[model samples]
Target: MWKKKTKQFMSAGSETKQTLHENLAFTAVEQYKLIRANLDFTLPADEKCPVIGITSAMRGEGKSTTAVNLSYVFAEKGSRVLLIDGDLRRPSIAKKLDIDNTHGLTDLLRGKGARIEDFQSKRRDNWYVLPSGAIPPNPSELLGSDRMANVLRQLREMFDYIIIDLPPLNLVSDAISVSPLISGMIVVIREDHTEKKELEKCLRQLQMANVRVLGCVMNGVKTGSASKYARYKYYGNSSRGTGK
Candidate 1:
């Protein structure tokens, strides 16, 4: 039974196959491959466009997870990468990466002696993290501040890629406000969860904000009827119903 479920989670369906982190260890390789290949195809030349944003139509759709994993993969390729938790209202990257959120972008923006060079938390290999220090009630205005833009510019000069994990486009204006400073944005949508209307609304929001959406990512997918690490016996045997 355990083998069967692992296969289901690893299936590459409408989802990106990253949720298996909690259940299995053998699936990490497949997920890493997906991340690396995804970046190569979607991202332009690193030198041409270094800053990018990872956003979603609504909350709880794995946008933060996407940003973190993508950053990890980019760093694995030997590129100096910075992953910033731009979702100040509900920052999750710091917790996800298990790093201290003592000071970050917000602290740096408020002229609290938090320079760009000071916010970086060197993790492993070439990866670094910038948590969204103390959550602010007024994230939108802060993100729009001139200080934030300057920080982004300084970061662009330092890292090969700067991946910002932002809040849901439908919930707050923060993502839209920060969009102009980045090279492009990627929207993450969950399978059977993101309605057509919601997606259209998100697109309209980005258009109104003048944010270029590079592409849409379908999360929580299912692929072949086999185990995540190996083939399962569920679909191959004639005793069971074959997937038509």
Candidate 2:
């Protein structure tokens, strides 16, 4: 499922290093707000926390950064949010957030039988983080396993929103494997970095997996004066009926 009437929101000069910082681009705050509002349409009508998986057609498109900042926006709005670094292959949230990656998704998937709270590191008052524990030999298999499904089930019950940072769809099976388990997907695309054919192939992969694409986030839009920072844009149908 996709739609034609796409809604778009953009920002200029948003740095990839720490868009979470207060001194970020002038349009940074507004950008996050619009992006959050865009995702609001995908929330369940009955209050079940929406699990939004963020991924890209290829790497370095800023998907992980988007996921982290999106979670921060939700948390800032008083929502209890959990940001999971689901990109086990090349995890980055731990480093980005400066949170411990000691124990996380992989540990739980391996039947650690631990409390969700124990593995998660609370970065902010409302934002809890679950870094990709340890790189495993079989990322795709671990992500698609029944244990992973159960982990997400538990996550849904424990937070207002769970934002999973998945790997690029075209480069790895990790994103596609876990796409079925999420409420919806947000595709991140860099202005000139991502290839057109790759984006098409990624969309087809999502289509074949039967995952609802909540929207597409366009990153690194060049602005004359605003080029000092990195910014993002989300294109989707904001008027679409809520949830998948």
Candidate 3:
């Protein structure tokens, strides 16, 4: 079942490269499901909206990984998923998915090139990725432009789910500019690495922008240990009634 999902999302490539990444993408499908299940319980009942933005409190916190894997898993479950690399300044989705970033969100937004469908890179299953395209000098401005909103609206009609990978909130205003366009936001923070104070500030920034923080993904968290349950309880309690 998982293999089917992975195959549905492999980018335009040779059979061998596609096969390799498909295997890699499926290896983390279960973990992706776990994250989605957690969010299922955490997000507000009315927030079943399909478009979601994945970001981080800081760089290298695994937001890209979370976004890519989540989209793959959701597609595996039969959702028509459209994953967008919205991090224009430092796009990583292309590399992660082994696709090109030469004609992604930036290109689509600038009116300098092709239609949204023309820019889409298909993967195994019902999964599709829109790379970040060229890194524009003014990414924040581009993200906030009306063109971006229009593109998103068009995508919403064509996809069952749209997952966006964004730059860390602390690093750029890109996330805030596009926040209103997404249904909710996921903040990824590496365990034992993100500073509590920084996390608090990031939350404040989101609040100021009036963005709905759907939840936080604690990356690099140790799995399966005597103390694993203890850690879960600690995080669960801390994040309850809050987006984490």
Candidate 4:
């Protein structure tokens, strides 16, 4: 049943990547549902509106895609999900979602008396997006500021799930600075692009910061077919999977 649903959701190649649109394939939806389930199982039961950070070992590993899709699936399941473009260094949620990027995280954290509602943009009935706003010169400092924490706290009261798309772990320290505030972090790795050594170093950095490693999403797994259903596999903390 699940397989059939997934096949219905996903059609072929690039089309399967349209998880943000209304015509998202069932395959993409199913994959995100699997990720959401894994996240639910990984987080503490007491944590509410849990802020989950989606990151990768390096750039182009599909962290933003994972974050957006995960938030879409959660909102589809009736949970109010807020997708935050925490990757201030290179924001893409606005462009990918085709929404307004006039204001967002940086604006809210700038301490200019900006409110959360002022920067937030709704993508769906229950799904919202907060773009990275204007790229700041000091992304690390802004992300680590007390204002950022306050923004998150305020968001938790209004959202059931706050999915943050952060910069790659190996590229910068921005993710590490924001790690302590999130409930857990999901590492996305491309099967062909991410090297084993790089993935190890990424995990080590997260470990040193005491970031809760929820699990990993193995992305870009080729099945020797031109199918649009990209293979995605999840592994929990106790049984982390090895990257290519």
Candidate 5:
């Protein structure tokens, strides 16, 4: 059996560059590359555009950070990647990436005659972002709407990988509503802060919804004398099934 590993979470402030892709350390970059490789191994060979959702059980578990870093790594591999801020209630991708959120996913879904290209903001040669524009009053309804599905379908035709930074599962039903549309989900869990009971509840919810969970990313684990030192490694090994 393959054992899971934990790595020291790279603090966003330590990097002089605003985004991880700009000035990420070798270890930190390798960690995300491992995640990307793991994700690729889990994806179906027939699937052209694998849409992955990154979420956590609660707030402050580094879901958005994982999503951003994973997207960056995928784009770095020369694949056309689209990172969408699916967390409409509390959007952060735009601010984190230093891009304008005036128009994006919500705007495109509203059917206000905005082109998809108009909403997409390119940060790199292969990476594009669709921010959660203008928070709506009914986020759940909007996420579950048919318009959202249509938008995803269109996006699938354009990008090789679509990464969605979703809201925490326990916080709201938004993540659940959009779960069915994604190819798979990656759960982000804080090392010491995330409760086991809460994590169980979140996993149960995903199971009840029949969502495919790729695996869990244990974040913010301290690297100290007491640590076991399970080094981050990416072998591109085939997965027997989802959920680790």
Candidate 6:
């Protein structure tokens, strides 16, 4: 099991990157690498351009951080990865990654007359980000719209992996709306924060929706929190099946 990563809740912009670099424990990095390996093993081999969604049962469970770091790890091998700010209601990727949100996923989903690439800003070599754009009046409607499908279709041809940072499942259905679009979803659960009931309910929701849930990632773990240490060790050994 990984130890509690200090300051896991990162600051905005460049500070986010700095905090991540400063605070990410060796165990945490290895855990994420293992997560990538597990996903690579579990995801259908035929799906070349996998679209993975990152979400949580409730807010502030480090879903965005997971998405960003996962994207970072995915791109480490020169794989083209695009991290999209799918949480249109309360966008975070732009602030977290310090990218522009002037026009992005929301814009493309609203039928904006422009190429999808026009809205995306490259964050690094082979890494790009499509921000949430202006906050939409009806995020669910836009996410479930035909334009969203079109945008994804276009994105598939461009990137090896598309990581979408979605809103909390318990808070809204925005995550559910995009469920059909993703190859699979990973639920982020924070230690000492996410309740067992909430996790059960989240699994029920995913089961009911028939979302191809990959599994849950345990976040904010404490090094010496006894059962939490044991629980995270369990997660490390059997990550993809632990939550369910």
Indicate the worst ten consecutive residues by lDDT in candidate 3. Answer: 229-238
Worst 10 residues of 2 by lDDT: 1-10
> TM-scores of the models, in the given order?
0.77, 0.86, 0.78, 0.85, 0.84, 0.83
Error of 6 at 244 (Å): 12
User: Lowest-lDDT window of 10 residues in candidate 5?
Assistant: 1-10
Clash statistics: count for each candidate: 7, 7, 10, 7, 0, 0
* Candidate 3: segments with Cα more than 4 A from true spot: 1-28, 40-49, 116-122, 224-244
lDDT of 1 by residue, 146-198 (tens): 88898887777778888999999998888898887887787887766887888
What candidate 4 gets wrong by more than 4 Å, as runs, is: 1-24, 113-115, 118-123, 224-226, 238-244
- Give per-residue lDDT, candidate 5, residue 181: 86
Question: Residue by residue across 145-191, what tens digits does model 5's lDDT show?
Answer: 89889989998999999999999999899989988788888888888
Error of 2 at 101 (Å): 1.4
Off by over 4 Å in 6: 1-23, 113-123, 224-244
Q: Write the per-residue lDDT of candidate 3 for residues 1-244, one digit (tens) a residue.
A: 1122222334524432332224443334445676666665665455434688988788887777678777777777787788888888888776665555667677667777666555344455477778888898988888888988888887788887789999988988999998888877888888888889888989899999998777677766665544321222112212345423
Clashing pairs in 3: 7-124, 8-123, 8-124, 8-125, 9-123, 9-124, 9-125, 10-123, 10-124, 104-133
Candidate 2 — which residues are off by over 4 angstroms? 1-16, 119-123, 225-227, 238-244
Clashing pairs in 6: none
Error of 6 at 49 (Å): 0.7
Name the runs in model 5 displaced over 4 angstroms: 1-19, 119-122, 224-244
Candidate 1: residue 133 Cα off by (Å) = 0.4
Greater-TM-score candidate between 5 and 6: 5
For model 3, what is the error of residue 33's alpha carbon versus the real structure, in angstroms, after optimal superposition?
A: 0.4
